[model samples]
Target: MKSLDIMIVDTPYCFAPEKLRKLLKWFFLAYIQTLT
Candidate 1:
């Protein structure tokens, strides 16, 4: 439980929303390109 809490605490630093959104946008474009 403590380890899980630590992981949760650590996650935000690794998964910042701005970075995640940018990556998601790139991935979405790449995925759309593949479908066409």
Candidate 2:
């Protein structure tokens, strides 16, 4: 979690609503893939 926070802070563009949404969607997909 700390690493994730640092990552977000480092990537300022993630604050943009559209980019954040896409990032979250991509993260969710990656998480699901790991579960499978």
Candidate 3:
């Protein structure tokens, strides 16, 4: 779980669709909650 958090934090900038970025950010926040 710690590794997953690190991976998300270490990800590079994205140039994809804006909608996709928003979705990923939401999921990422949920994931971090689990770690806490």
Candidate 4:
């Protein structure tokens, strides 16, 4: 997660933060569902 944070900071131009955040939120939700 630290690495991902660094990557996000390093590549702000590559992906809009708001969109990336929404995408990450969806992915995290899916991951949680799978875990259960």
Show how many residue pairs clash in every candidate, following the order shown.
Answer: 0, 0, 0, 0
lDDT per residue for candidate 3 within 1-36, as digits (tens), equals 677667666665386478867876887889878879
Off by over 4 Å in 4: 1-16
Q: Rate the local accuracy (lDDT) of all candidates.
A: 0.60, 0.66, 0.72, 0.64
Which portions of model 1 miss their true places by more than 4 Å?
1-16
Could you give the candidate ranking by TM-score, starting with the highest? 3, 4, 2, 1
| Clashing residue pairs found in predicted model 4 | none
Model 1 residue 34 lDDT score:
69
Residues 1-36 of candidate 1: C-alpha lDDT, one tens digit per residue: 355446445555456688775665675576668679
- Residues 1-36, model 2: lDDT tens digits: 456556655665546689686886687577668779
**C-alpha TM-score for every candidate:** 0.51, 0.54, 0.60, 0.54
The parts of candidate 2 lying over 4 Å away from their true place are 1-16
- Worst lDDT run of 10 residues, candidate 1, spans 1-10
TM-score of 1: 0.51
Ranking by lDDT: 3, 2, 4, 1
